[model samples]
Target: MATKKLRRSAMLGRVVAATATLGLVAGLAACGSDSTSSNPTTDSPTASDISGELNILVSSADASDKAFGEVVDAFNAKYPNAKATLNSVPNDTYPTTKSAQLTAGKVDIFVVKTFREMPDYAVDSTSEDVQLAQSGGLLDLTDEAFMKNYTPSVLDSQAIGGRQFAVPTGNSYVTGLYYNKKIFADNGIEAPTTWTELQSAVSTLEGAGVTAFGIGGKDTWPAGLVMNGVVGGLYPTAADKQALTDSLWDQSASLDSGVPLEVLQKTQWVFDHAQKNFSGAGYDDMPAAFANGDFAILPDGTWNQPTIDTAVAGAFEYGYIPFPASDNAADNKYLNGKIELQLGVSAATKNKDAALAFLDLFSSKDVYTKFVATSGFSSAQPDIEQSEFLNSITDITSQFEPVWESIWIANANAGDAAAYPFNYPALKPLGSDDAAAAAAAANSAWTAAF
Candidate 1:
């Protein structure tokens, strides 16, 4: 596990550095959706011609990323005057492409990799990027009835100062433990409530010739994702260690400043416990192994649920559980999630009302139901019923809200340089056994400096 972690950590740096040194980095990485129907409205005196084409951009490596086409299709059904076109972009280049489009005013409606595209996404005020979007006159939904459809945290992601720049399309991706129900039951093992219990469960599975945890070291994000669970499990209160999650536009306290090194150090234990072959696995590989009952537990994201369910095809009984926090059952569950896959209206959109109308359609109960059911993701709107995946994910999110809120506050103060490492990249080396000493040294350095 330690070796795997080291390899993964090195791989991530190499990838980033390689992209940098080679000047191979380009903008706009993502696939666009297919053409959908354009619903043209009756000619209006007040608004721009309703029959003109509307451009909607979806980002991803795969041109057919699901929501883009479906959205266009739905929109075109009613607005015959509007036709939708998909623009596929690579993930790595998305930031550049999006920026260029914004500058050239070539985009009417498009998606941006908010987290990656924004340099100081979690912090920094007066960032030209955010300001540009705001200046473009974002479709303000503050007073719109659809505002009721989203959760506050979801909305908060797009909100700068008092105004919102985008509409939330989905909630954050949650990372936790997904276990095989039959494996636990057959072994007479209960779902672990503490790190110790979790270890015991893993040990039981390993003794029976199954991998204890199905981990993916490839697609580096999952490495961070799983580690988040481990870190959260160790420091249930770590969420609050950060004072702000909206630091990008504010001058706030350091999110990592107050956290004890001991909390961050617990990741060492998680590193020691991970499966031995983690280095060999990729994101897609884990669910395939889980379905085969090769592992008893997997630390991945809620987004993986759809794939997991499909892989198992109902042959196996599986359950999603919050990662345990140390050995204390009384300690609150800690959850790690991301605010990716959100939606924002084009600031330049001439059809503010129509754009908002489309956003409202996204938040509609029917859309929420369909999206969650199909995507295996959760929703932000509190009123929406919890799908099976949401039921599990939300339980953990609610359990750890206090921790996240604190982090939000701290990040708000510390900005990017401070907040990002506390949440990501910082814990990468801790999972490596060989790097245990290095991890300790890094932890001490961060703690002392923080």
Candidate 2:
């Protein structure tokens, strides 16, 4: 119920904005053929009828390749004549490359960060999906049978103008504190459920000469995750969260007042209590440090499960919990649930039948299960069970509220500026003056974007 409430409210602003943009684009692209069909049979092609070389563009992450490769292998078995090859690109360059490939009609299938990148290409006027359908740049799989297999809420979150443009591959519940269970046990410390308890734990850990938290502050984005998790706990409603975000751009709120000040204070606390030289640490170092028992907690996402497992090599136990933001447990109920990846068919592709077939196969329970399990992420498809590692976090994730990063700023570029502000690196020491200055710089950048 908490998850549903959070999702519904958090997604409203983006969805409404996208829907409006889509409407405007639809009006302008009236001459374009409407490729979006609500009729399931129109887009559904049987495996036997599908035959072609399908090229899929995706990020070059190892997990992505492994999971996609497995799906391709299974898909080949179903339709031997249909060959799907993955074209891997660097993660940082995906948006630019994907946009170029889509515009040139060179890519058949591609991965999207769902509401973020896909909407940009889908619509015509820098708007949303309806224009995408009207422009004939994206396929409408609203009535597609494979969609029935996914959780309705998860699928709907990716929808624009009441149409499904992509199918979600995996869900990530980030912004959790992964603690060294052995260290906690040795110190007789339980996972903190409230802000006061979390502070107490940090004090105890620090007094024991154990690092309270290990942060990849040099990477900057990790700092954003910490802020998001804290915001979830501090803000009780989606509107409350959105108000704070809007203030960053609109200048309605100041860094020294309300949520902004609170966030700065909390960030200051984490920085004050984190391991020495945390600001000098890199992203890769955090997992190793935590696994080696150098720290009691590491703030990160569910995606790190495999990395930690590999680092620890079964030497110690660890578990994740939502970052506590408030003294009241009721207010501290949320997790950073994000749809990490979504598979979409290019609207300009000539191989529509093959693309449709691949989508169907990819969304099938069997294929999707293997992909999610291999990636060490929770399955967005309700019928497919999450991996054992993900199951361990069910205590937090089951009742988790969606993170602001996923809902408010799904676009990678916008997210970078909105989530990881400029001058955030300089604010590491957490002075009120420095935090205020950083917030001002970030707000200016956001305003310029608009």
Candidate 3:
């Protein structure tokens, strides 16, 4: 079981975009009011007692798709009269597809990531999910019996105004590296606990005739993961990161200097030690590259462990650890994460009973264990059995620390770097500019918005 935190240190806004379908959402908002929008049928039924056709839609992920499928299979098995179907769309098309389905009244359960609150400076800002929820487009699961299966603290952090709308199936720790255990032992270096030690380990690995890091820069987001690791280490607490955001928003901070500069420089250092042409390398290729001992470290989310294991094929042992960005080991103990597979029952859903029943089945201890394990996500329920890989990183995940991605909302008016708010993409081989120059450009864009 993941050591449950009594409370999340902070809760932040969800990144907003996918605006093409906002019109469909707004136009169909009133249509969803007829049924199960706010108050669904009060009678809650177990799988065996409910009978209705169900359609579930979600964003695509290699592991998540498989897990949702298994849950649906179990739902069918348990609910004899239930006919449930899942449509997992590619991430690129998921938003549009979900909107299209909702407009057509074809989806029951769908994925949702939205704001419970906005920054003080942006009081009126809203995301697509916020709009959907406000427009009566989602069923409120606040008082649902199935929701009790999750940890109260976890649910509280995701709730808006004390009302829960989505079910967090699980989450993933993202601010860390997947290191080859054999490579570390062979190099006479243990997992580093400080920024200096990590730099030394990188040197030791490179001295042993190996690339220090393997990043899938071609896909872009993988490289961004390294930046997240840097931020997590430099600003180890929610208060620290929030202060930085406040300073930036008030024009009291600059990305080109202070800790922000350190973030850029350290991430640049990581990329510098990576395999040649890493920027051109594909994310799908890194697992095999590490499996073949092409690199000593791979910085990524825990969600990729199962995929990486498939490539490793039992050739070498690997462990995931916090990146240790700070000089103090104690400060780097927590791993930053974001909730994954958050499920919302569409107000437009016609089969409310079956949809609610399926969620009920999915939340049960035995079924959720299988779903989370198959999904490669950290368990969201307290006292629930965590997957073996999750168990390995229990030291870091003992605390519930939301990642900067989850806590920081991107400024739409700012340039690309400000969106990431780090500009890892603009540095070095990923782009033509050097780290300092990239940070300067990002600073300029961020400042212009002020």
Candidate 4:
């Protein structure tokens, strides 16, 4: 916390704007479809060569759902006989759904987000992705030609045990709060950079007979997301977050006290001002509710912009800002992002060639550029022109700081409170217990493992 200013300065900068001309990557384009012609060349497969059913499963994020569809359509176009279909499951149920699909061998390509660092506590919570990769349930794409199309730095960040099992589709900043510009302009309130200012804005909105925040708490993760935003402000740097995690594991930290408890307090502030019965609100309905001016702010990730845009349909202008969960402005200056929507091929796929071909075509500059543009994700591939929405958020996104969820490893065997570390479900409005009770319960469960 003391070094936040230094950290912010170190991170503030422009995103790498690729100036290179768009063309087939010299070596990486060998397996990728020819950019100039759809017909086959000597170096590449013909339209009929790679033909089979290619089904991709990913957790639902409206923009990503469509961007993935772009790849499927392209694959179908290049290989007319090939059938590629995209299926999305809700985030809350994706794990079980993905596992069932993988067990049945119904999925070819699926989203993979795992703990690449593999912390000590991670063993209890090993993801299906990690297990698949470790046990060879995932197709190895380490030497794939299309893998060369991505930014090397992005690829390096995703590598597990010096190997790549998944392709990073694009990057996303998740700590953003989508606000109604019309509501703010009418209320004469600006984006808050500190907790005090955030409270002021909330009070003013309440005085104007408007709900301060709209959240989809029925799905559970949305309210939990506020704790994540608070964690970002509490610990701004990777070193700071990593140190906190180490402290927790080494018995030097307690969830009921210090920074961990602070995260819950700040998160509760958000829940306290949310629209009535938001705990019962469906995640799917928030976009339309926000567009109808039901609430002034919607805590969301950048990936939802395209969906919100469609829902808003010019009814009102909306803007996104990092959630201000701290008392210090510098701590809340930047949005934390993750190498999101990474995809990998299933080892059980009866059509491995088709899966590889889809990834090859999907990663090419020509196809990837349009994918990023429509997916509402920041370009993961270098030099792709950013969409207008991405450009609008450059002030906060110029430097990439990984989110708390990306940094901290949860203990699966721990109680709900110790598991997420914040335990938002135990707090009022969302639950019957208060912060103190929740934190105490967390300390109880957390200490049991040690």
Candidate maximizing lDDT: 3
Of candidates 4 and 1, the better by lDDT: 4
Top-TM-score structure, candidate number:
3
Instruction: Write the residue-wise lDDT of candidate 1 on 1-450 in tens digits.
Output: 111122324334433433442211112111111111122222222323345555565567331366556666766676666565556577667656765664454566666333212325423323333443344433444666667667775565456656555555655445467888988899889988886787777678768777676667655556555545544655455323332233322424323333333344444445445667565568778778888877777876666677788898999788877678567765536465555455555555545445554565566787666665554455666656666666755656653232232233222222232333343344444233333343444334333432
Displacement of residue 88 (Cα, Å) in model 1 is 4.1
lDDT, candidates in the order shown: 0.53, 0.67, 0.79, 0.74
- What TM-score quantifies how close candidate 4 is to the native fold? 0.72
TM-score of each: 0.70, 0.80, 0.84, 0.72
* lDDT for residue 110 in candidate 1, whole number 0-100: 60
The reply for model 3, stretches above 4 Å from the true place, is 1-49, 114-116, 120-125, 207-210
All-Cα superposition RMSD per candidate: 8.4, 6.5, 5.6, 10.6
Writing each residue's lDDT as its tens digit, candidate 4 over 253-305 gives 88898778888888888888999898899888989999999999998887778
How should the candidates be ordered by TM-score, best one leading?
3, 2, 4, 1
